[model samples]
Target: MEPDIWGIVWLSLKVSAVAVGVCLPLAFALAWVLARGRFAGLVLLDAVVHLPLVLPPVVTGWLLLLAFGPQGPAGRWLEATLGVTFMFRWTGAALAAAVMALPLMVRAMRLSIEAVDLRLEAAAMTLGASRWRVFCTLTLPLALPGVVAGAVLGFARSLGEFGATITFVSNIPGETQTLPLAIYSALQVPGGEAVVTRLAVVSVLLSLAALVVSEVMARRMGRATHVL
Candidate 1:
C-alpha cells in the first residue's frame, strides 16, 4: 500500500480507538443506570442517550458542530477552561465517532448488566459490602465481557463513521482524514478507484475483525450469566 493509504488506515484506527476509550466508561455508567437505577425520568434519559441512533448522521454532526464549534457554548467553555479544542481537529472526529457509537455501546452493556444476577449483588451488600464495593467486586467483574463487547462494537461503529466525522472535522488529510473520509475523498478524484477499493477493503476487514471479537465477548458474557 502507498504511504498515504497507510496513514489513512492508521489515522482511522487511532481515531476509532480513542473514541472507544473515551466512551467506554461513560457508556458503562449509563448502561448500569439504565439497567439498575430506578428514578423518575429514567425513560427520558434512555431516550436522550439513544437519540443519535434515530437522528440522521448529518443532523447529528450539525448538532455537534453547533455545540462544539469554536463559537459554541460548550466549545468556548472547554477551550477557555481546559485549553482544548475540537473544531476541525482529529479529536473532533473522535468525538463525532464516539457520539455516533454511544448507543450501541450502551445497549450492549445494558443487556449484560441486566443479565447479572441481582441476587448476588444483594447478597454482597448483605455481607456489609458497600454499594460501590459490590459494584466493583461482583457486578463489574460479571459484566466485564459485555463491557469488552460494547467497546468492540463502538470501535467498529467508529471505524465506519463518515458523515458526522466529515461534517464536524472537514476531512483534513493526515489529521482528521479517517478511512471512510479518505474513501469519500478518493471517490471524488478522477482515476482514484484503486485507492477507494484498497481503503474500502481495509475498512471492511477491520470492521469484520471487530465484529468477530465482539461476538466472542458476547458469548463469554452469556456463559458467565448462565453460571451465575
Candidate 2:
C-alpha cells in the first residue's frame, strides 16, 4: 500500500477505536435502562437512541454539526470553557462515527441484557448483594458476550462511516480522511480506480474480521453462560 493509503488505514483504525471506546460505557448504560427500566418516556428514549438508524446519515451529520460545530451552543460552550474544538478535526470525525455507530451498539447490548435470566440477578440480590455488586458479579458477566458483540458492531460501523464523517469533518487527508473518505476521494481523481479498489478491499476485510471476532466471542460467552 502507498504511504497515503497506510495513513488513511491508520487514521480509520484510530478513529473507530476511539469512537467505540468513548461510546461503550454510555451505550451499555443506555442498553441496561432500555432493557430493564420502566420509567415514563421509556419508549421516547428508545426512539431517540435509535433515531440515527432510521434517519439519513447525512441528516444525522447535519444535526451533529448544528449541535457540535464551533459556533453551535454545545460547541461554543465547550470551546469557551475548555478551549476544545471539534470542527473539521479528527475528533469531530470520531464523534460523527460514534453517533453513526451508537444505535448498533445499543441494540446489541439491549438484546443481550434482555436475554439474561432475571432469576440469577434476583438470587444474587437476595443474598445481600448490592445492586451494583450484583450487576458486576452476575448481570455484567452474563452480558459480556453481547457487550463484545456491540463493540465489534460499532467498530465496524465506524470503520465504514462516510456521509456523516465527511459532512461533519470534511475530507482532509492526514486528519479526518478515514478509510471510506479516502476511497471516496480516490474515486474522484483520474486513474484512481486502483486506489479505490485497494481501499475498498481493506474496508471489507476489516469489517469481516470484526464480524468474525464478534461471532466467536458471542459463542464463547454463550457456552460459558450455559456452564454457569
Candidate 3:
C-alpha cells in the first residue's frame, strides 16, 4: 500500500481511539444517570442522548457544524477560553466520532449498571461504606465488562463514522480523512476501486476486531462478577 494509505489507516485508528477515550467517562456518567437517577426531564435527557441515533448522519454532522464551527457559540467559547479548536482539524474528527458513538456507549453501559444488584449496594452502605466508595469499589468493578464493551463499541463506531466526520472536518488528507472518508474519496475517482477495496477491508477488520475484543472482555468480566 502507499504511504498515504498507511497514513489514512493510522489517522483512522488515532481518531477512533481518542473518540472512545473522550466518550468513556461521559458515557458512564450519562448511563449511570439514566439508569439510576430520579428527576424531572429524565425522558428529555434520554431522548437527547439518543437523538443522534435516530437523526440522519448528515443532519447530525450539520448540527455539529453549527455548534462547533468557528463562529458558533460553543466553538467561539472553547477557542477563547481553552485555546482549543475543532473546525477542520483532527480533533474535530474525534469530536464528531465521539458524538456519534455516545448513544451506543451509553446504552451498553446503562444496561450493565442497571443489572447491578441493588441489594449489594445497599448491603455495602449498611456496612458503613460511603456511596462514593461503593460506586468506586463495587459498582464500577461489577460494571467493568459493560464499560469495556461500551468503549469497544464506541471505538468501532468511531472507526466507521463517515457522514458526520466528513461534514464536520471536511475530509482533508492526513488531517481528518479517516478510513470511511478515504474510501469515499476513492470511490469518486476513476480506477480507484483498488484503493477502495483495500480501505474497505481495513475498515471491516478493525471493526470486527473491536467487536471480538468486546465480547471476550464482557465474558471475562461476567465471570469475575460471578466470582465476586
State the local distance difference test value for candidate 3: 0.89
Residue runs of model 1 more than 4 Å from their true location after superposition = 1-3, 216-228
Instruction: Tell me the whole-model lDDT of each prediction, alpha carbons only.
Output: 0.88, 0.89, 0.89
Q: Compose the digit string of candidate 1's lDDT tens values, residues 1-228.
A: 243988888888999999999999999999999998999999999999999999999989999999999989999999999999998889999999999999999998898899889999889988999988998999998888778878888898999998888888798999999998888888888888998988889988998887776666667556532211
TM-scores for every candidate against the unseen true structure: 0.93, 0.94, 0.95
Please give, for residues 18-79, the per-residue lDDT of candidate 3 as tens digits: 99998899999999999999999999999999998999989999999899899989999999
Candidate 3's C-alpha runs over 4 A off are: 1-3, 222-228
Better of 2 and 3 by TM-score: 3
Question: What is the lDDT, from 0 to 100, of the residue 216 in candidate 3?
Answer: 72
| Ranking of all predicted structures according to TM-score, beginning with the best and ending with the worst | 3, 2, 1
- What is the clash tally of candidate 3? 0
What lDDT does candidate 1 reach at residue 98?
100
